[model samples]
Target: MIPRAVSKNGYAVLNAEDPLVYKMKELVDGRVVCFSMDENNPTIKRRAERGRVSCVYENGYVTILKGKWKVRVEKASNIPLTYGGRAEFMIQNVLAATLACFVHGISIEDIRVGLTTFNAGTAQTPGRLNFIEVGSCTVLMDYAHNPAGFSGLVNFISKLPNKYRTVVINVPGDRRNDDIREMGEIAGNNFDRIVIRAGHYLRGRDASDIAALIQEGINRTGKEPQVRIIPESRDAIQHAIKYARKGELVVTLADIVPDDISHVQEIRDQILKKQQATEV
Candidate 1:
């Protein structure tokens, strides 16, 4: 569909790492610009050999290759959206966005400002990796519903310090049952504790049924994690925070963005107040 829309003069931005996407270049009548995590990716190498343009992750920076010249855009570790460059998917997204923007003549300095200033906060991208601190634990809220997103999330969680990880997941009922189960399986395999909750809309399925499917997936995973079912989103968030160990993390795959963040913030405020009262 993307290639179908590009004119002969327009450049098609592609991910060199994805064989399937790189193959689409054959279908494109226009010039192809590529981005990749690997600087030595075959396509990126071939493009470099010909002095074509591409964006790549090199030495911890998002670098652009123009013929033989290497232009550094920004460090992935400095961008808040990539969580200090640990979120590979976010970095790839940044690379793709940067390549597309450059293809249309967006300046490198403007891109740097955008990357450095932008963040995955509630005020910016709500429910997209928003973090809140309560008591001795940190809460993470992200809107990850599919397998790919969940995999990226799992990777992010794995990179954190060796602390107890609790995830309050509430996948949308609109997804295929398999996907929901898969989410459960991934969460179960990684997190130390799991809380399955109800999404904003259950669509046609019952909340209990959705929870049961997730439970089934957890059972399929031989690795056992303590699992709980709190059908309400608010209740689920509270449960995760309440049981969070000192210096641990409570992660929530939020269905409702701002509402969930606010809910956790309220909890944090209450915890702060109680601590203040005790100090007196």
Candidate 2:
């Protein structure tokens, strides 16, 4: 019986030896299934020594019972998952969502709605997959600053219809130069043109240094990919948008803050409102 509570600050409280503690002691009072352990039970040591059973005494802790061994259980507040767990959870959730939507006669649009409405925390706003329509061209803003995501995005974009050319605007965080460089190298081979931007350099690092690192990686690939260094992210985006042809695709990969997208959404709303008023 384990007792746990969440504080106002969003932290959890877990304590051992509480009244609600479940499975605290194995073979309590010489019974295989006893309600609680008696303090005077002498068999407790012998049972622990035999390693017959184990228990979880507290909300965030597990206790192991060995022959003639009794010790305090360590509390584990948060159980971190490995890559296997992540893959399992992702597959399970996607399958469940797909099945639910299919059984309910939901369309593709309805799938998006269900994900956004019901699975708020689980479904993140599509980072690189969010297609922004600018005239006849398409632009995408993605958080693909990592090598895996960058490679995946390149492969995905290459398969898209009317993908005449791909312009990659990569902006990596200052903290991860090597990661950004590797990402750039991967992107250089995949995209037609590569534009490197200094992303999040305001956090006490020189933008030029980060750009140089990315350039070094790109040069090492020997692909001679068209590379340009743009310090400002907004300028990089504007430049990419300007160069896009009717059927080309411009992809901006960066570590962007959430508020940046919100601001863009607000601007879009204002524009829509003005257009509506004009029509009326």
lDDT against the true structure, per candidate, is 0.89, 0.49
| True lDDT of residue 67, candidate 1 | 74
What TM-scores do the predictions have? Answer: 0.89, 0.50
Give the Å error, residue 103, model 1.
Answer: 1.7
Model 1, poorest ten-residue lDDT window? 154-163
Instruction: Report the poorest 10 consecutive residues by lDDT, candidate 2.
Output: 76-85
Query: Residue-wise lDDT of candidate 1 within 1-280, one digit each (tens)?
Result: 8886789989888989889998999889889999999998988999998988999999999999987889999999999899999999899989998898887899999999999999888888888888787899999888888888989988987898847999998777798999989988998788899998888878888988889888888888998898988878788888889988998889888887878988899889999999999999
Clash count list over all predictions: 1, 10
Give the C-alpha miss distance for residue 70 in model 1, angstroms. 2.0
Query: Which parts of model 2 are misplaced by more than 4 Å?
Result: 1-128, 174-177, 257-280
Evaluate model 1: give its TM-score.
0.89
**Evaluated with lDDT, which candidate comes out highest?**
1
Tens-digit lDDT track for model 2 on 20-55?
332433213322311112212334344445653323
